[model samples]
Target: MDPFIEINAIRKGLADGEYSSAEITKFYLDRAKKLNSQLNSFISFCEEQAIEQAKNADNKIAEGSSGPITGIPLAHKDIFCTKGITTTCGSRMLENFVAPYDATVVERLNKAGAVTIGKANMDEFAMGSSNENSYFGNTSNPWDTDRVPGGSSGGSAAAVAAGMIPIATGTDTGGSIRQPAAFCGISGLKPTYGRVSRYGMIAFASSLDQAGVLGRSVADICLLLSQFGGPDVLDSTSHPIPDNWLSSNPKLNPTKPEAKITIGLPREYFDQTPNLKSVEIAMRVFENAGCILKEVSLPSTESAIPAYYIIAGAEASTNLSRYDGVRFGYRCQDPESLSDLYQRSRNEGFGKEVKRRILTGTYALSVGYYDAYYLKAQKIRRLIQQDFLEVFNKVDLILCPTSPGVAFKKGALSENPVEMYKQDIFTIPSSLAGLPAMSIPCGFQNNLPIGMQLIAPHFAERKLIEWGHYFQSLTDWHKKVPELS
Candidate 1:
């Protein structure tokens, strides 16, 4: 069995009886278990449950009742609640927490018959740019074990890159999905805000959090996305757009004529970024494809980092208030009073980065500072959104580097929080504007993968898929898998 087998091929094999779903599931499960010690990509394995689901999928296949994703194996980010599985959100606060009900994302995927192999590790409470914030320990990049896999979706990205799974679920509160995808050399999509249901995915920043997918190729990401991307009754914020666009196989029309498509290269992005050799080479792939490339301005790009952190922290402070020791999460031992219990439990259960955000958030939302900080940040967010909207009027899509540079070594920026936040400078503006964006491996820099990001207008995921699929066809970057031993 090819560890990098495409999902469509897997589906065909299952249907033709070439290999049973059980066989594929076991193969990935064995691989994941074997590599986990070195990569620490997964927090828990659903070995028994995954095999059972695979058997059931086999039955469905035999009866000709299987759905599109039936028999496919996937790993869910720990942030998403899986019934009876530990949904840790990469924090000790929920380390022992088992969800009683499946999250909407998990529920929809299960309905499509995708087997859950395990829960991927993530930054604690989905905080931080590098996976180092994860309470379980940093998730190592498959390309370079000593370097960080971008977080909080790092584990999902690493698993796919390491060939432990063909596809996995990820969430992007800021650049969580795209950053890790860039670091680990895989395809990751962060759909427009509210494009996917977030009912059961642990809240990072309510307005910005979105569940997406990570895979070896954009086509594979689309395959898993079609199963779960759509409005859900449980999440009020979920957009009502029909998901029919995702169902179409991108491979059918591999290379759409690109002459009419206008891709904007943000002048601000290119000016600030230092190393552009790999990204420059990638732009030529587009130029050769006959796509028009124009320089556009997004002046608000510089303000994105400040605005994103403020907004995300504020929301996180509010959402995480429920994790008091008095509740179901981690509790301090033998507290004398409620206040002592709350303080000690949170201080102990939460990680250093999570605590920092909570404190910053609390201060921003405090009585005297709300308007001075939080309100101002919201106003800036509107400007950021307007900037993208303005640029969209001139260009069909926006192109930029996913990160300022390739993934850095673990703990490289540990002491410099501000420098670390800049890792997401290129990816945050899109998230703030609630637009669909993705990271595709474009080339390598110093033996590390370099990712180029594509941003489309709101609800324009189909366009992104079309262009990204075509780009993947033009280059072998997305096909370049790390030689994980």
Candidate 2:
């Protein structure tokens, strides 16, 4: 079997009995084993457990009880808690940690009989725009080992692109999922806020963090969303399942071909980003797709990175307070006093980046600075969301380059944190607006990949995927695999 085939193709093979679930699992396992040393895509592999699950899937097939995801091979980001498996969130603080329960997404995928190959690496506590913050190691882009895959979900994207897994789950806060998928030349969607339950997933910024799916094509992404999206009674923020994503989305179904899809080109995103060749490629791809392009203005869009940093970092500071060396995570070897233990444990356990954000967040949300910085940033967030809402009223979907350019060489942006934050300028608005958005590979730039982003209104993931599917049908960008082929 060609390991890079999308999820739906594997399903077709399974339906015809051409490949058993176990065989499919082994295919991905062998691929992962071969490439993991070079790519460092996976933080941990559940090889034995994956085979067991595959066997159970085969048993279900034998019993004539099949589900949409039965026998499929998928992976989870290290951030998503998997029962009895390590859920490190790519931070050294929890490097030895294992979750007692599976995250809602993991549980759902397991119940549907999907085999989890392993936990993909990510930015430490989902912090950086690239995968370099990882405590385990940096994830190398499969396309060019010297270049970085996007982060903090870079591992998930690189794994799918390298044919190590059919699909993987990712969490987007800012541009984590979309940007990385763009860099790796895969398809990834950041569903509307509250679209997927957050239960058991490590929190970075509760309001901004969203769990999403990454795959080789739009169809595979849609299939995963249909099964995992919707309200979970366990999560208070979750909403009722939106209408059937695939059937109702006109872009996915061309029954109404006359319906012209409008694509918004945000001038601010292009103007502020460093690269234009990649952006030009994306614009050409959208124009080729028969999309009507219009210049849309979102004046406050430029401030997104600053506002997002304040908000996400502040939330992360609060959310991560529980890891104060007292609980189940890494602790100091010996301590003379309680305060000494608290300081020493965290000082030893946390990586430099996580600690930096913690200090920044804690200070920003501090008593005297709360109203000045944190509260003001929240107001700015409202303005950002309003800008998106107003723009969506003018266009069916907003199109932009997912990142300024293709993957950068490792250590390229390591020293300049501010420069790294700028890479997300095009992607942070949707996260701020709680909208449905996706990154689809449009073409290649200097052998690396460039992703064109599609953004839809809240609960309109169907629309985003529809346009994505239409675009994929026309172009072969998503079909391109890494040299690992």
Candidate 3:
């Protein structure tokens, strides 16, 4: 019943007949009840259903039919709709909305026998860098309650770090998964865009939105990915299945000599900030792993932030138009007409930050501005993708800080939208390029964790995870815990 055990350890205990799935499920539920007040992580609780699923998993295991993740506890960001679960997406607009079916990711996890604890909070419609934008309330960092847990996947990261659950799911449109993972000192991976199906997961920017895993360790994440990854006919974007990613390949030796492996450092990413302490820690880890660091130019990297804002906003503006109060989302009371209902429902339901992005997106995609703004942004996005592809020709992986710095105090960027967006500078480009990326704790500065990001080319997550695994084995940063328990 120890909440601190990693997923593998728990699985081993279950396989050894030390605990049944029912017992493991109760352990997490009790821990969640104990911690939810302080962490503000889950949006809803699925206790009865989770227990039922866990019981089924126990039966399967007794029948000698269990898989790696069978009976493991799992949580999903609210953005991924689970049938009959109140999937608010952390917005008042959908406060009472329950999905008719589960998201592909949720369905896969269910089939794997992972018990769903509940939906985790997120930025209203996944728009901000900090959890402050969530209508459900900000998720406090377990490391320091006064500081923010980076978002829009902050709740997912916080849940895992706080030990409410060992593994959770998150989506990264830009840096949603990685940034929060960095702030909370957890391991998160944003796979290449099409590596996992997105069907039934609420849309952000379709082209950029990707499903990923947030877990206590690199190994935990790898196991989750093996279960949730691969193609699904329901989602046309899902890529074809590849060889087993869980097994290491002989050709890719993560511990090879520095000259044999190249890790790129984009000068632009560094020059954007004078502080290299976070970057410095990551470099030391790479060196410790025998990686040869090379300074490479991703010249278009400077345009990433601006380009990301335009394209993501435009897509969001179009996608979010469905929540017009006429559909399944929240509706205004006593509306005189349809227009009145749409305006009031949205105005009242959306949090301030979500409203701002909607306005920004509408402006960019508006008739007169479309050609000059949205179209131009798409062009820049193409250039950004090209830059990464070109850089990959010379390097096996790219290393950078997940955030410019560590987690900030809750109110730090509340009134400043630009400053909030800047927190995503190092993360957006990878999402824009549909590249697989991860954030792993490198070290701590001022008692707060710093995350180092690793990005690999399309469908190259195996390599990225391999490199991350090697780095994590040599460093104990991932093992550090907040005194929350």
**Candidate 2: stretches off by over 4 Å:** 246-258, 273-290
Q: For this target, which candidate reaches the highest TM-score against the unseen true structure?
A: 1
lDDT of predicted model 1: 0.91
TM-score-better candidate, 1 vs 3? 1
Give the alpha carbon lDDT tens digit for every residue of 3-22 in model 1. 99889899999989999999
* Cα lDDT over the full model 3: 0.87
lDDT of each: 0.91, 0.87, 0.87
For model 3, residues 202-256, the per-residue Cα lDDT tens digits are 9988889999999888878888888878788998888877536542222333363
- Cand. 3 TM to true fold: 0.96
- The whole-model C-alpha lDDT of candidate 2 against the native structure comes to 0.87
RMSD of 3: 2.1
In terms of lDDT, the best-performing candidate is 1
Error of 3 at 344 (Å): 1.3
lDDT of 2 by residue, 298-318 (tens): 899878888888888899899
